[model samples]
Target: MNVLCSESMKIEEEVSDDSGTAAVHSLPTELLVLIFSWLSVEDLALNVSKVCQRWKDSLYFRTLWCDKELIYENSREDLFIFVLSVAPALKQLSLNPLFCGDPAAIVNAICKGPKDIRKVHYNLSLFPAAVASRILGHYKKYVCELHLEGYANKHSSIYRNLDAELGQMSQLRSLKLSGYFDTKWDKKVLERGCLNLHHLDVSLIQDESDSYKPFLDNVKSHLKTLKLPQFKSNVGVLELVSSCTELKEITLCLDDLRCISTLQSLESLHIRWSDGVLKSKMNRFVRDCPVFGNLKELTLFYIPGLLATAIAKQCNKLETLNLHGITSCANIIKSVPSLQKLCIVDRLSLRMRHIQKLPRYIPNLRHLNVLGSFLNKGIPPKIISQLKQELPELVISSEPFVRYTKRGNKGYFTKCTDSSTDCSSDEA
Candidate 1:
């Protein structure tokens, strides 16, 4: 009876092992489909395709090919061919037209597919409008967001026509056009107006007489955010803010200090200027313009001298302030009392000498981002300890040490031993 029992136990063990193997081999098809959907197009072709016939069969699902952002090169024709075969429901598409061997033909083929394309981004310079128009006419039902970059003067007419067609798409909510512009074409589109536009970004070419006033006036009612690079004049910016009651954010890449006072309702302001330019304009803006009283965030790049002081003194309500590539911002650091966050980037020569001087003015600062040369030496232990003591929540990132410690926490100052070094050693 014992021998018979042992033989039965052996049989049962073997049967259990086989059952486990079978279960492992038979994974649910739905799970496999889900796994493949997460893979990128290139990875799917290279790795997933080698899995087996089951994966290849699962790849046939049209959902896998619906939305794609691809950069085509001559050597990757096989990948493109595979994508064309697999993805049929393509919606949003972005690509570098120059990289494709025959961009016009390839675009036509892709747009011809029965995909519900709603948004498209491309290098406008290389795009052939004849093909684009055809694609748009067919897929106009759901098309909305359009982003065109790298445009030049010659293509202004093309962009105008494209804008006209885009205006027809009732669903279009955002349009970003970057590159050179034609004065006449821009005026035409601005006059016609984009009824559904909520977000618009236009990069002005070197030509100053682009009549931006009309464009600003037209979109002033519906425009939510405006970003202008190298805008030298205050007239256009002032008009834009006064007219666009709904405007929430404005980013100006102007060097003129005079224009800073013109921004009234701007909640967020980003200014990029050289040391001299920043000093002149920032001082004027801080001392003369009270428009920044309501500002929540302010970003300064390469600003020096008394300008930083002016900003800190005037923009008292600013919650976040970012100083980058500034050599002399110590005065500003001493005045901002309500500042909650401070970010310093790529100006080690400036920050190493000036950062410690900041605690007295911005006592309530919670977050700090220190990058570039300053981070190389790591945060001074004394400074870290002082920060922990003053600010309840502190984050410091340096090369040798990246730490987060709360106020009154023990071992917060163990990293840096010298707490008595006078901040006076830091130069102005």
Candidate 2:
């Protein structure tokens, strides 16, 4: 703490008025802009803008709009107008329902605003179907990635609208269709929307009907990644997956290897037990998928032991691995020379023995993310420091979850929820 304070003091002194010169104001505008980019929107609006005309000019609100990262909690009413005016520059927009004021206005703005916005994250459980439909309709031609929450339920009116808009999503690439307990995936819309999709996630529905036939039929040749919904069985999508000639990535909660065994083209695989799936025969699953010689990335959630060892032995071309709930490193696994990134976050049994074996197995392992641990004291700093010494190129980090403040600055660090971590597994 004292060291941090001393560093802060030193930084302040370097930019202080010690030389009787207005050094800060005299700096180049380009350098000032680079420094100001680190500040939050609130800082730019309330503090930095008040410094001088030159400073205010350097803060481009339009450039801020390009981020499309919204923070509306306790925000003013005019935020909608501001966002709407600058929606053209944004690539992604996040909406939180707790304080999602002026949804109609913001949606209207984005609908008519830009063709560049490719991603939208709406977290309102009861977001209006009309607004969602309108925005999606407007951005249908260009939007590629879509993540929507709390709308696909039996009771929500947005499902119908979303279903109707499915056909128009011509360029849509990735879809994360998370829903409530009563949500049902309309087979026709699902099939139509998936025609050109490379990545599809529908893991929040109440029931996944065998209607996956048509959906898989349309994208069987084009689909690269598929995430099955909760409570759904592999039997429902097994035959469908069998037909996908170009399938490369698959995330399934059920421990079903037969469904993935035939996909020789698979590059990334994620397996786990779903809430509705019974005892997972992980050993059989791994044994069945020995044909995955082309696999590059593998993720196992709540996985049993022995499976990782099997993967290490078979998928020698593997580059990234994420293992959660793994008790031990299992039997002596062969070295996967191509492995790059490894993440084992929020596990109870991961120890030095498990970590120490990485360098022996994955020679090229570079970025190791052991972030968001709530159950136990995460990987010790001393251990990480020592590992760095042993493998100088290996980058190890233990990060706590951090969110944005109301003022748009980085908020405090805290333990993230399980659902949040699960959602971020792919991106991480």
Candidate 3:
């Protein structure tokens, strides 16, 4: 009887140990919440909500929400509920007015819940001017960043109301406005009210006759970054650049290269131009622009010879150079001794003749991207083989064709086993 009791006790202990092991394998609810917090709210609502009821409950936590909110058709209800639940914690909000019928209701809901809201972005294409004005006036105290886009026709009252309401935001730091504005009205609001603005992106709807000098001059001293598609004249560009002594980066879609010469403090430049006449001007602009000497990165689309030469000579410290359909890259590479990464997209044609001319001066070369179907055909196997021998430390990657070799004491090609064989792996 004593031996039977001992055996039964041992069996009970074994069962208890197995149950403990199973409990240890299961993830705790707190750990799951921490993991879900890293995901965007949209992703959580869409994917995690279907996993289980516990996941759905975890999604309601406000800390998981991102600073920027983009709403689409499927997730409209989720966002609406989220806003109502945590309106006070919200700082930045972007709403598609086309999908949202009641802009005033949304604004009121936000104001009632959270008086701390600081930024608001909305598409004003459909909202009446009066409604927009009412919404803007309500949040004027806390709102710092505002983005609005709409047609600037006479019927749209939003433009005038916007100009008026914008003048009242003393804490406003960033403003992005897209549409036409009355010359006198715009000048008055910018000069008198937007004194604290540090970042500005405006698409001028008015003609060149409308002098924007006052607005530009008002914000120039505080402006750190400026992006504009087109500038009317050389004077406007010069005034804009000269005023912004703290300007670190500038992007322009215009063809005129002449503007580059005026921006002395520019550390980064991006441009896209099509016409050959404009391309020639760009070349000249790059050569003359002293700003290129301080530039760390440059992105160009269809830039011509003089500019390419100028970039190589002036941008000695350039770390990244991105060129699209560039015909004169051979000249640029010769000058940029500090270049570490080069991205080239040859849409016109891919011929080894141009690539072979690349200077051997790039000792710090780490990454090279070549686009165009012909790049592979243009480069001979011998040249590729020789490059592999010379640049043993270099990492050569072309989507669907990646070859990596290590730089040993004595240079030699060694196949990299870590490379993926799938063709689609190089999409990035």
Candidate 4:
């Protein structure tokens, strides 16, 4: 009887092991990072990391530790140092004046702890030029992403040393600056150094002169992604942008449709329209503008008129569309059929009917950011519920409130992908 029972138990164990679901441990590292990314950093550290040893290791190593604000929230330098030590696999680290008074000390501590710093962020204006140089000098080889930010604080101002130090970091793939109007430092960095940089975000102080035209001309051929500052230009920066033939993505205004005609390799475009932009120019662009079949992503905020329809009709390959400040449901449903992700904020014409009709038009749509409300009126629960039920595969959610790095003269939105869609950093 004992022999028979033992044999039966062994057989049951074998069957369970063979037929059961795959173990969570077998999941790919990239996929696991994607899953844990859904949780907040507080929840991740306090809750998720305590689950198991494997969970702790995975969280620490695979995940990219961002959110410099969290360091301030904790208010402990030793704790930040501990994080830098354990997360040797850190992909990026951003340090600002909010965290520490001395930028040099912060960089020294981080460099001593982690050697694999892939991206580093600091505002030159926050630190003395020598200290800023020391910070960049530490990550000269490993840092591929550098944001030598500019701040308009009374305590900090940009200097030539900041630009000179940046030119030494040859491995930089992405870079952002406030504006080169202060000196010829802009020309010095790109012309004399940092040859590998492909992405550049520049924000001008005011709408007075085209001081950045020379910098744009210098980087026209080598640069692939460019974000110009937010200046009220009726003519748009098309004249300067036309020279950048290698540009894959751009965010600028368009008072004249003819500006887009010269961009052959353009993939993603964001058009910012203020109150006074001529509707006649937009209409003419829609009617006469050449078909941008390669363009896959487009964003238009506060743009007037029926231009979205015209754009969607023309750019048949458009897969991602972000529109805010007065948009059309009929135009979206009838046109951009290839759209996979759509962001619509505070739509004047968005109704339950449009929500219902949305699925039929864009069957392949997988992500929807239906955010913002009309005055005090919130989005109806029933509409959100229906969307979930009908589009089972779609990941639908409201937008999170974004807290920016609090700088004046910010020009463009920042969104960068490995191969698609370029994002911009804040202006100096």
Write model 2 residue lDDT over 133-201, tens digit each, in one string. 766677778777877666343355655556557567888888775655243456666665634778877
- Steric overlap count per candidate: 5, 2, 2, 6
Q: What is the C-alpha RMSD of each candidate to the true structure, in Å?
A: 10.3, 10.6, 10.2, 12.7
Question: Clash pairs of candidate 4?
Answer: 150-428, 178-428, 230-411, 414-423, 414-424, 415-423
C-alpha lDDT of residue 421 in model 2: 26
Which candidate's lDDT is highest? 4
- Candidates 3 and 4 compared by TM-score, better number: 3
CA shift of 170, model 2, Å: 3.1
Error of 1 at 383 (Å): 5.3
Stretches > 4 Å off in candidate 4: 1-75, 81-87, 98-107, 153-157, 178-181, 186-189, 203-212, 233-237, 256-258, 373-395, 398-428
Task: Give the Å error, residue 133, model 4.
Answer: 0.7
lDDT-best of 1 and 4: 4
How would you encode candidate 3's per-residue C-alpha lDDT over 266-330 as one tens digit per residue?
Answer: 78777666443555555566566677788888888766656556656878679888878767676
Q: Which clashing pairs does model 3 show?
A: 88-114, 283-307
Q: Against the true structure, what is each candidate's TM-score?
A: 0.73, 0.71, 0.70, 0.67
lDDT tens digits, residues 1-428, model 1?
34334433322222255455443225445555556667788887666767788777666776665555554556776676566566666566665455457675567567655556677776656656676666555655576676766544455544546555665566766667666554343446645644566777664444555434555566777776776655564566565655666666766653544443555667777766633354554555567787678888888876554565566577878888887776656666676778888776754456555666566667787777675645544566667666666665656544443344455656543333333432223210
For model 1, the stretches where C-alpha displacement exceeds 4 angstroms are 1-26, 29-38, 57-68, 88-92, 113-119, 136-145, 151-157, 186-194, 203-214, 231-238, 255-264, 274-285, 351-360, 375-377, 380-392, 397-428
Flag the better candidate by lDDT, 2 or 3: 2
